[model samples]
Target: MKTGKRIKGLMACLLVTTLMIPNVAYGSQPPYSDKAIQRVMGKIYEPTTVDLTGMKVVDQAGAPLNAELKFMLFDTTIQEYSPEVHANNGVLDTTTLIKGHHYILSLADANYEMKNKYFTLDATGELPKDDKTNKNSDSPERESFDSITVTKREQTLTEEELKKVNRIPFCDDNNGAGKFVSELSGTVDMPDMADMYINDYDVKFKLVNQYETVELTVDEFGFLQGDMIEDLNYAVVMETTDPELQNYVLLQDLVTSKNHQEQGENVLTRTYTHYTCNPIGGIYLADSSYEEGQSMIEDCTYAPLPSYSKKSTLDGIRVFIDRGRKINTDMPGALFKVFRDEFVFNERVLEETDEKLVMDFDTINMHRDEICKLPHGDYTITTTLPTENEVQAVYNVDRAGNKVEDCTFTQEGSNLSIETTSVSLYNTVIEFKHVHEFEKIDGTEPTCTTTGVNEHWKCTSCGKLFADEQGENEISLEDTVRPLAPHKYEDGKCVVCGASDPSITDPENPDPENPDPENPDPENPGEGGTSTPGSGNISTPGSGNASTPGAGNVSASKKGATAVPATGDNNPFALWTILAFASIAGIGSVVVTKKRKSN
Candidate 1:
């Protein structure tokens, strides 16, 4: 048994060992140990100093460099210290770096103008890969060190140096760093005279490099003054946000003056005055690409740039007046007027001699003329006819020659040509006609009604009223009648009309000698029968004088006789009281029987 126990213990030990073997083999190795170094050799390694020799320096063209260029060596492991070294004759021979550690080789002076380069040393003779140069194997190496070649960096010019070489001119002696004035002068020419003036517009100048913009309003002399940078190029843009000028095309130009002095002072001045032609006008006959109809003034000068022009031809419009055939008499004298933008062109009276009025309307071509020509804008034509009178009614004719009732003169703008259809005149004749006149015929005075009619005068000539025929205009005289009040009956008599209700009977006057005792009459009590408590010959439950428990009885036996009240027979709960008493007695008997049997 002891041996068996020992064997069992041995088996348990073996099982535990087997379970721990995998964990021990796969566990993490100690930090910085040989096994740890082997595990992380490629990914991480200890930093140690290694010797570097026979390094050479050259230019980008592969020529050897002879100047003494100072460089810095940085140990990535201990980044705080960066030792300086000097390279001469394109060689650096005395530098010790770490194997498996990263190192940076950079020019010691920022003015050296070269980017820094990094290298990692490995004792296994593996070269580090460069992101730009990759791995180069063209150089011979020493027994204890590696050789590398570095190139000289390109130099960058300073700001002042750049300006000197480029020969950029400035407005001021201090490299154009002062306030300067900019003057803009120009003349605008339009095809048609407009209310717009030179002072109504503005010019904007923006310096591209400085990110500055300023707006200058034009003066009455067609000149604007503002501040600008002397050494910078400007983008001169002329525009207007006014609602009246939004239709005009905007002008823009890039202006740069290499000659600081144009004619005199240091002021940068330019002249650009060109009108933006309005393109709204009549149809054009020329090619759409050419602007033909409108011409600019000789004095108007632009920035010697391409500009847009508008050309158009003026077309004639006609106006016609006619007297409607519907009028039996001559047409009334009427005034006709034509206006364009508050400018009246024609105003005349329409008479028998002057049948129609003809006027010329101008239409401009948009392609040729930059703007719409005069007399082509909004036009309003108004006609005034005679007012309606008792004898005749006057009206205006529509486009289809239909007579318009109550037509009045309108002053709204329209593009349609004036042409009257027909005017009609009728004779004034008085005629009597029947018209509705509401007369109250039923209610009180001043009541409204629609049942009565009165005679009203109507004109057969122009449908006008001159007189009203007299009619019954007072309240209705039929009657002030109402429905009878509903009847109410009480005790066989109506309470409202004092009439007898034959359907209702009086209990007090019921059939004599056969009257109902339940409804006894107060005045004649003996006629029905008095309901005295002990006098009625009715049998009541538990009315005898026998003394018994559980019996519902109340006796009046002062004279040795049990007299039960007749009202006891009318007790509503008499049956219920008797049943309760019997139930108690039966339960008591049942209990006694059960107890006796148990004993």
Candidate 2:
């Protein structure tokens, strides 16, 4: 009887030790270890529970609730949720989790009653209801509870349950009207929603001014088409009433058509967004991976239902491509590339409606009429060809084909700007002008007779000269000439070029060399004269009296005179008389010519 009691006592001690094993194992480590937090923040955790594992929650009726679950440690001392332990989306890993620690599993659900649910894990690593006896309550109405006996269930939703959840993928909308039509046909579009099941439902149009409901069938292209009543100023609400779309959040449900009669038909578009809410109970800290004192789940999922009652003031744009006189036959065809503007916020592009403008050739053909619907923003148009085929000017035209004077566009080489602000089909005429490819023409060096041109530029294809490098300032061929230089003559012959002066009668016999006027010969008093043509001195024929060369010249008529023997007689007197007569005759001829006139 004593051995049996001893064995029973040993078995009871082992059971006690087993119950305390959890605390002893977790005691050495800090509460809410950093490694567990890193797993919760795997790169970046989305608000949805799709990435979470190990637990599945259900409602009171045993239906699986698509709720976001968050596991947090309870501080026994404070009697509240603590930062010591945290696991996102009910991710319970037995190897990593602490033993014997009281943990609270909170739920974030759309249903308000189910949102306040909390579960606890006891000393044996089993989840059980928090009974009110432990300062907690099984009744969800009571805010706080501790001990309660409840059923523990863990199973994922069946395929049928997932289908019933009904989450419609968010669709992107250009938020602008469609193509221009001849008549005012009302159109409704759900952009990028062709493949989704919700797109097959009919759109309901409720006229507010009149008690009428019209159902428009969705076309094969996944859009609604109908015509608004002519000239009836009744307000219309285009919406979806299908019960399957109850969970989807409508982002935008209406588009205001401006000048529908003037610019033809417009399209009314819709936007729907889907998201799963995240739990919002955690002590946010500065050192945590998320924001300080804030929850990423709450911030991301919080949004009010979108409402659209205001009038849409959208504008339409029409492009007229004028391939102006392309005179050069050798040049290839010119192409203009269009670019829609993008609006960015916080390093993210918020709006970029269309990027396929350049991809579709028929849409932006050279001369075909193209009318496009665009949001109110700036746009750029540029040439795809080389600089030789650049845009000359861009004119904003009216419906009457006349240029609009109110708005002006700027052109920087090949680029042109356009801004849509009004309902006018603001005709944008892109007139392409041929640019000149001017090459530098080296100038020719001028000579004495021929004229040469200065440095200038000439068009490679067309023979046109321009003074400036940009080819703006045009110049004539004569304007670029370096004038002919005159012949520099010295002693009846040109010094620069060896050409004789035409005015000289006989260049070889040039005349008696003239002496320097500033210097006088010492032998001849106060006289500056050159030497005779053949000799330095003139020897008188009759007398030995040497007439020193003075300011007098022997005439060319006396070139062949023979030297007579010195007679020392009347020959010297007669020689002076003959020279005096010759000088007088020569002076008379020059005077007569000076007074003469052309007949």
Candidate 3:
């Protein structure tokens, strides 16, 4: 019997410990103490300051309940047959109520309830309800009790609140007629949306009014296509040239002062942007890592009113291409040249749209050939216009890649044209189309002469030229010249690989020379001293022409040695020395010959 009792006691102790495990294992520790909760418990009775206080306590009789109520509303229930009570009433626990984001108070029973017997208690809940015991039999027509209020807690902004973007993304849609166009009149800024909206919808319309008009807009999918044949002030138009005009123009939000020009006050310039588009919805996601989509924009997308630019030129057409490069793809066959020397374009215009860019080509394809041929060194094709003109083009310089246009060129109002040319695999392009003021500027041959230079003199006049010591002679001191024909480098030849043709190497002139060499020899076998076209130094045999008794002139090749005097009838020893010392007097014995094996 004692063993059985001991076993029962141990089992009871195990059961109690097992039940306590849950309470101790994962329950949350309240950040505040019960005393902290009691400090602000007098809020339920003061109707005036009800919402002002964060937490409150109340009694069963609607009085200021004692702060020492160490209980919480664990659950709620609804009692209804004909007249239904709140779903939360007697329907859930404190955990579920906190989870659902709201709190409700209700009575436990209907007939057993008194008047105002609905309010319950949770973590600071009030007790507006009194039990049937509190209600006397004379209490006429008992009324049900229920109420709901904010839980007095902080929360994160909802999706809708974040979408508001602090009202920054909203248009001045007062009554909604001219909302998008009215309030915005500035530059560009880009900010990420906290949330996205209707990404799959498209808008198709032809809105027209006094300020703006959409000729024809057909957006059916995720693509954008619209033609706004709008009349804009030249200055205003310039300020909104970027494709993301809406985003960019937000930069204007920072301006505090501006002289608002009345509409139609000035007659300056015009802008026309046509939109021809083919909707292509799904974008090429980076994670996809597939070579998808059309190779070119034209193939996959359509733009009836494709974007373009009217880049500013000094009043007339100005050329801006080198020997074989072209401008603007807009006019594949057209080129640019400046009529006026320099000017500044309107910054606002470029910020608004790139259509005004005169350079028909994106900076990426300013030239048809690969830029790798002439890695982005300081090579520019420029011409002086009638006036002083300057331009700054911001662009992307990808290695072995063409430049990507990224900025607008601002210039003053003047007639200027930039020169451009178009070329391809077969048919070459050599035409001039003007920017700013569209007047054709003819391209004359580079009015300078190109003479061939070996190692010596430059031929200002047309003739064979060399840049070596043996100037324009038929022979070259260094046998090496000319590239390996077509398969060669851009700036002459590859020094390391010895890969080039004669066009890059001028064995007779301007040969490559080494400076601060480890071994300084006038005749360096290294590529550093390979003879170019215009190295200016040559050697020649002496002149042996002279009358009797008059010595012929000659210079010795070895430094510090005097020239040999010709032996004639005047000097008897000269002849005898040659015969008597015949063993040592070999022909041309004054100098030692240098021998080298060829590579």
Candidate 4:
């Protein structure tokens, strides 16, 4: 038994040791440790439980509220408050809370009065009841909270202020009536209304009489209600106390509308729907008695009606009178007149003028520039020269500055130009050449007696000559005298000169030393050659007298008479004649020989 007791003691010792070691196993420990509990306590505190059913709330109208109601909770224990909790339809229910915590509840709304209540929540949940009555019970009574009512009031104006309003004068009016009216409108804001309301106010229209102020009332939306009278002045004044209301008051002038009748005398109305609050002051009417206001006046008068005369110009014609160095002195004094139909519209004397004559034409029913045109129908320009001077010639000059004679003028309506001359004015120069008498130069005829040169005819005015009439003619010495015929000899007897031989006899006149042997008569052949009948006295050939064969000089002894040869040892006429014949025959023989050689 002792052994058993020792064993029990050992088991009891192990049990004490186990108990002293502290329970640290996973399943043996509490669900939460003290450190974990302290950490949770740092994050959150205990809340109070309170019932909010007894709290009362209402709107300004003091009826049961149907809006969202909010409540705020204040905890006395933790010295902190909770976020506001909202209740729909103004009803609050039970809420969780902390024991032994002092709490306060409050509601805030702009449309309603604020309410506050304080109560303590013991360990048991309980709340204090609201004991306040409805605060709107003693407020002023209203018909409906949704809309407000407004009343109209009219104010009178003084006489001086009425007259200060400007009226439309008769002079300023297009139609002869002097009528005027003023129109005005504005916007106002009503309670609880979001947008601006237009033309919703009272208006007081005032006017000045002879000595007093008169007022007209407008009970409707403050617009000018009725038509105004003709030629009447008016001013508008608005009355309102609302901060959002605008005043439209102005001095105006009005006239009658198209629909207004004269019998009704209704003035026109103009509506000004948009306006501001700035005050429009008094008006001032214009004085209509000024002289400038008259529509019609007297005509103006002056000495000369700004007269302008007509003139003409020759565009391309430049008259050079003296050697192309000076213009004609009488050209400037030339007169030009223009006529329209049968009436003379313009006339001008070209005095101290250049080639161009500019004039101002008094056109009765036409333009001045148009009336200045000449030679078209009745319009003409006639140039009158001085009595002492006349236009001798109207010629033009070429590009080389040379005179072009007989350049006649061509008239196209009134435009005159030189024919075949340049059309440009600068390229044309008109000249009036001087006229003078000229002497004719009789030409001499060419002479055949001697060598002479040709003579040409010429004029004295301008030393110009005609073409050559005759060429030079030379005289031949061989042709100055008659030539003797050549002698033909047969059987030592001369045939032409009736000599035995031409070399030994004279043929011009028969003589004893030289005689015509062919004519020697068989009877009386030695009787000194009895004189042939009708034959002149025979002499030596160079001595004289060879009678012409046809002048009834002939020898009766011979049928064919032969003349005596010349007596001179050298007869120049015979020698020259022989030489000429020989030359001719020699040339003919040369030509025949050449021809034969060629053939």
Over 4 Å off, model 3: 1-154, 158-164, 167-172, 176-415, 418-599
Stretches of model 4 off by over 4 angstroms after superposition = 1-424, 431-436, 440-447, 450-457, 465-599
Q: Which stretches of candidate 2 lie over 4 Å from their true place?
A: 1-392, 397-407, 410-416, 420-427, 431-435, 461-464, 467-478, 488-599
Q: Provide TM-scores for the models.
A: 0.18, 0.21, 0.15, 0.14
Once all C-alphas are superposed, what RMSD does model 3 give against the true structure? 36.0
The full ranking of all candidates by lDDT, starting with the best, is 1, 2, 4, 3
For residues 1-599, what per-residue lDDT tens digits would candidate 3 score against the true structure?
Answer: 00101233443454344334432211122223334322212121111211111233333444333222112231111010112232232222232221111122222321122112222223334323322322331133333233222121134445564332111101111111111221111111110111111122222223322223332322322222232211111011112232332232110110001111212224211221100001111111111121344122112121111111233211211122211111122222111111111111211111212121222221111111011011111112222223333333433323233543233323343333233221010111111221132222222222112222222333333233334433434334233233232233557655435556455545454444533343245343212332211121211224243322322222112343343433333446766887878856653364333222221
**Candidate 4 per-residue lDDT over residues 1-599, each given as its tens digit:** 00111233443453344335432232133234435433333322333354434333444454445666555565422324556756555445446665433344544333332323434333333334221222221122311121111111133335554443222222111333222222211110100101111234332344432123344333233223333222222222334454433322221221111112212344322221001111121111211221442211100001111112222222211110100110111222111111111112332322222222222222111211111111111112223222222233444343355654344554434333333322111123333333323333343432323332333333345444443222123233332233344556786676545556735434465565545564454443322445443344444345366643343444343444554543445336877999999999999999999999999
Worst 10 residues of 1 by lDDT: 320-329
What's the number of clashes in each of the models?
A: 28, 11, 154, 27
Candidate achieving the largest TM-score: 2
What order do candidates take by TM-score, descending? 2, 1, 3, 4
**Candidate 3 global TM-score:** 0.15
Return the TM-score for candidate 2, rounded to 2 decimals.
0.21
Give the lowest summed-lDDT range of ten residues in model 4.
318-327
Error of 1 at 212 (Å): 38
* Cα lDDT of model 2 by residue, 482-557, tens digit: 9887887889788877788877765444443434343234344233344333233455454254553331443221
